[model samples]
Target: MASLSLRQVIKRYRTGKTELQVIHGVNAEIADGEFVVIVGPSGCGKSTLLRMVAGLEEISGGEIAIGPRVVNQLEPAERDIAMVFQNYALYPHMSVFDNMAYGLKIAKVPKDEIRTRVDKAAKILELGHLLERKPRELSGGQRQRVAMGRAIVRQPQIFLFDEPLSNLDAKLRAQTRLEIQKLHRELGITSLFVTHDQVEAMTLAQRMIVMNAGHMEQFGTPEEVYNRPATTFVASFIGSPPMNLLHHAPGNRPGQILGIRPEHLDVASDGWPVQVETVELLGAERLVHARLGDEALIVRLHEGEGAPAVGSTLTVRPRQDRLHAFDATTGQRL
Candidate 1:
């Protein structure tokens, strides 16, 4: 396990006389054996940053260091990193054991050593019983595990996951997520997982990097980013259903955008008057979609709490300390 560092990393694409910069001077330091997730919406440069670190994409400026060595100019094989791609990248004709041992074979590792490493990885990934099956004979989750097993056997310094759960069903994704968490705990490998899903980011990350529009929005522990977002983009992007941003919201300073999460808004007697537009019952809780003048807001109501019917009027007040204020022009947190 080793620490990963990104210092003022930049990426650009040149088309004729024009240069389009995609990653803008991003900086982050990931501790050894920590699980760090890079999350954002599509086209936000999250994957680009990951590829850069994997030595697939060239950095336009600055440095990327894996452990003690700067890996910017090194080949992907020389980086001492293992990348598990989204597609599972397993060979259809190869057995699970062969798939896991392929890399070691390519590196000319001795046969007995490769067998020991593959057996250990198979045991770790719970693929020991299925080692004789080909990729076609295995289930999706099993194949994904085989992919992970291939990476695990290498015992690289860092593990890179590029949305490894995207192709699985909801239940499988959840189950595999737990498996990955357990794998991390048992192996204690340094990992950098890139995903656009906030749920994955919140659940899997010890710390996370939030990116938007070619720039890093915030980098912090999940608790810090969730409880106190550093920017409006972070506030809006990191949460489920996202934070509501209202211009000139009640009790907000002039020229500032008021931000509040649905769960933080409470039913109050003297609060912002809202006209209920829709209500969605989500088993344990209900989401109340309402209008406050021209702005739309969502309030989360727990079970046992009375829910407002559509076309009805109610008042929802944001908790004082839970409220977030951001600059109207720049969207930076205030």
Candidate 2:
């Protein structure tokens, strides 16, 4: 395992007349064996950053270090890192064992060592039973396991995953997430995963880097990002149903935007009057869709709490200490 560091990393592309910058002065330090997720919406440059670290893309400026050595000019193969791509990319004719062993073969590892490595990786990934089977014979999840098996056999210092689960169905994605967590615990390889899914970032990351418009919006534990978002973009992007950003809220000070989460707002006898528009009964909770004055808001209700009738007037109060205040103009937390 190896610690990874990026100092003021930048990526830019030349357009017809002007330069277009995609990643801007990003810096981060990932501890050895840590699982860090780089998350953002599509077109936010998360994949570009991951590519830079994997040495698949050239760095426009600054430095990238894997463990003790700087790797800015190193080729992808020389970086001692393994990348699992979105596509499984398994050779259809090759059996699982052959596909997993091909890299070592190309590197001229001894035949016995190749067998030992392939068998061990297959066992770890639960692909032992499918060793002789071709990629065409395996299920999507099984084929994905084969792709991972190829990476595990490399025994690289770092593991880079570029939205590896995006191809799986919802159920498979959830199952594979558990598999990945288990793999990390057992092997303890340093990993960087890139995704646009906030739930994946929240559940899988030891720490998360939230990105927007190529800028590093926030980098911290999931709890920190969810509970005390650093900016309005982070606040709005990290949560389901998102936090409410009110410009004309009762408690909002002049030139400040009031922020509150759905769960932090409760039905109160005397509070902000909200006219109910709709209600959605989620399995374990409920989402109340209402309008506070003219602005729409959503409130989360726990199980057994009755939802108010549509078109009815209801009062909701925010937990004072839980409220977030941001600069209205800059959207920075205040």
Candidate 3:
């Protein structure tokens, strides 16, 4: 495995005289064996950036290097990277064993070596019993594992995953995530995973890159990104209920916005009065949607706490230390 580096990476699409720039100057230094995830909204250029690193898309400006070599002009095959696509590109006629062994076969590896590598990868992915099965006979999760096993047999310097869990059911997605974590632990390959799901990003990433409209918003561990978001876009995008940004929050200074998480606010008798608009019960916790002046905010109540009635006025207090402040004009954290 080798470290990956992106130095002022840029991408642009040209049609006649019209030019559209999609990726800005993105720079990152991903250490060897680190599982870094690129996450953002659908059109945020997360995939574009990943594609650039994979040598699938050409970089319009700047440089990309894997280990010590600059791979700006290298083909995908020459980049020493294996990609696991979302669709699980597999040969219908090939069995699990053949599918995993195809790459080694094409490279003219000896028959015994190919078998050994395929068997090793199958064992790692728990596919030893399914070696003779075809892609059509396997479950969706199984097929994805086959795809991963194929990448494993090649033992590339890096692994690139393009939303490999998007096609699975919720339960299967959760199970596959655990399998991937285990696989990473065993193989320890440098991986770059791209996805639009925040939960996947939070669970699978060692360090995550938060992208927004072609810009690299933030790059850090999940805890750092969730606790101390660098920008308002990150603060609003990373969480489930999302952080509340109050432009006209009580006691806020001019040109500043107050930010607080739903779980950081508590129901109190002497604080900001808000009228309950709606309440949602989610298993172990309750979400109270309320209107404070003209602004809307959500407050989370844990189990054992009584849910406030709708249309009732209640005061909620924000934890002083948990509060966040941002610039109104720039939408940047202060």
Candidate 4:
């Protein structure tokens, strides 16, 4: 296992006469054996940054290192990193054993050693019984597992995944997520994952790097990122329905915005008057969509609490300690 570091990395695409900057000076330090997930919306450069570390994309500027070696110029093979792609990228004609052994064979490893590595990896990924089947014969989850086994057999110092769970069904995705978590625990190799899904980032990452339009917004543990977001982007990006940020110009703190999470909002007999527009029952969650002042707000209450009826006027107040303040112009937390 190895620590990974990227210092002020940038990626630019030459478009006819214009040079477009994709990743703008991303700096991150990942410790050995830590799972770090880089998350953002589509077109936010999360995958671009991962590919830079994999040497699949050229770095526009700055340095990337795996362990102690600066791999800005090193070939992907020499970098000791294995990557699993979103599409699985399995060869339809090759059997699982062949797919898993392909990498070791390319490295000119002895046949016996390749077999041992493939067998071990297959067992760990729960693909031992499907070794004889081709990708086309395997289920989507199995195919994805084979892709993971292919990477695992390499036993690289770092594992890189770019939304590897995106292609699966909901049930399969959850199941595969558990498997990946179990594998990471067993191996404890330094890993960097790229995804647009906040839930995936939260569950997989020991710490997360939240990126926005070509910049790092927040880098913290899942709890830290959720509970103490450093920026407005992070507060909205990490949660499911997102935080309810009202445009309230606090009398003392003029021009600053206050953010209150949906769960932290309390609707009682007293507070700011809110007119409920709709109440959505989401199994365990009841979302009361309301208008507070001039802005629309959503309050998430427990299903057992029984949400307010549409058009009902209620008082809403947020827990003072849970309130987040941000500089409106900069979007930075206060």
lDDT of each: 0.94, 0.94, 0.96, 0.90
Candidate 1 C-alpha lDDT tens digits along 1-334 = 8999999999999999999999999999999999999999999999999999999999999999999999999999999999999999998999999999999999999999999999998998888899999999999999999999999999999999999999999999999999999999999999999999999999999999999989999999999999889888999888877898899687778889999999999999988999999999999999999998899998999999898989999998889888888998889989
lDDT of 2 by residue, 12-98 (tens): 998888999999999999999999999999999999999999998899999999999999999999999999999999999999999
Extract clashing residue pairs from model 3.
none
Q: What is the lDDT of candidate 1?
A: 0.94
**Which of the two, 3 or 4, has more lDDT?**
3
TM value for model 1: 0.98
lDDT of 1 at 84: 97
> What TM-score fits each model?
0.98, 0.98, 0.99, 0.97
Give candidate 2's whole-model lDDT: 0.94
Error of 2 at 236 (Å): 0.5
- Determine which window of 10 residues in candidate 1 has minimal summed lDDT: 246-255
lDDT of 4 by residue, 1-334 (tens): 9999989999999989999998889888999999999999998999989999999999999999999999999888789999999999987788989999998888899999999999998889888899998889988999899999999999999999999999999899889989999999999999999999899899888999999988999889999999999998998899988998767623327767789888888877766788899988889988888887788888888857876778998787778889899888888999
Ranking by lDDT: 3, 2, 1, 4
- Model 4 alpha-carbon drift over 4 Å, by segment: 249-252
